[model samples]
Target: MERFYRRDFINTLSGVRNAHLLGTLSYKKVPNLGLFNSVTHIGATPPHLGFIMRPLTVPRQTYHNIKAQGHFTLNQVTLGTYQQAHQASAKYEVDEPEFEAVGLTPYFSETHRAPYVAESPIQIGLELAEEHHIKANGALFIVGKVVEIRLQSHLIADDGHIRMDAAQAVGVAGLDHYYRPEPIAQLPYPRPGQEDKILKPKNN
Candidate 1:
């Protein structure tokens, strides 16, 4: 059976990709960045990632940053830096540096030519590859090609999986609530009658 919810169902979903995207302002000059909870990994083979821009919204700092640099870093938002992430999202004057506002440090990227939040534990370098507009809701859909991902050495699990439990990254339910994640399964999304195998690790 198919299921459906109000178009605003996203506002009710409990877990979402809330990240701190860092980039420099092209039009305004000073540092421009923001916290975006709408990011996702699109494809793994060629490493495509995606994020959305809510429609009718005036141009955003991070949007201008991407336009200026053609690159941005998706900093894994953490509890320690959630405050900074939230602070960075404020609509500050285009010329004002959000990092300066929060006293956070910016690290220059060697790969993508964009800056990332130095305080973040992990980050992904990305370059814009595709963009489309969501017609019904008027949202802007963007796909970024992953250039590189920086991660701490120990976050790797014994099976070589990203030990997200150790990463301490935080997610948002909507606009206000934030929480750490718990893993239920890794891969091989299961079908009915596959429950027993689903619970077992194929890698073993």
Candidate 2:
């Protein structure tokens, strides 16, 4: 396959992925926003999450800021803000923050220096926990422990599951395409000999 063809084809193989606007702050106090679809759940007990970054062959403002400040924010890109979130992926000067350029408001909490997207319904602040460089590809895997979560109280179910569909959160396929997910009835946590049982439908 051709270079661009191969890249585009392989990128979508994982299907639609959660898209977030990762917020960071440079050492000089410049706030930055970048759209990232590589964010992944690392664990639940300690509340850890991670995202992948490309190789350092080029300057990655997001990676640099996260390392310098040791903290960052992940703001869910909702249907209302998906266009602006996609615009954040554009290359901008180090001093030029994407929040301002893309017409999104940068919100700061009293405790964390990293800015969060005011328009995002679900925002999470995280502290750097670990980082690993992939030997084969030179990409970086950055892990963060959840520090703070901000969202509407009504979005959470009694069982602790978040109703992302209610939030209208958007997903990304390949690199540029965006999608909003619909809830297909939630299934019961499978148990031995309970395969036939299904939970009552709820917002998922």
lDDT for each residue of candidate 2 in 108-160, tens digit (9 for 90 to 100): 99988899999999999999999999999999899999999999999998988
Q: Model 1: which ten-residue window has the lowest total lDDT?
A: 1-10
lDDT of 1 by residue, 1-204 (tens): 223444346575645655555555455446567777878768899999888877846867677668666887788888788877887777787668678798777787665577777888888888888889998988888888988888888998887777766888888766767778888766775578876664455687
All models, RMSD in angstroms: 5.5, 3.4
Q: Which residue pairs in candidate 2 have backbone atoms (N, alpha carbon, C) closer than 3 angstroms, thus clashing?
A: none
Give the Cα lDDT of each candidate. 0.75, 0.91
TM-score of each: 0.82, 0.93
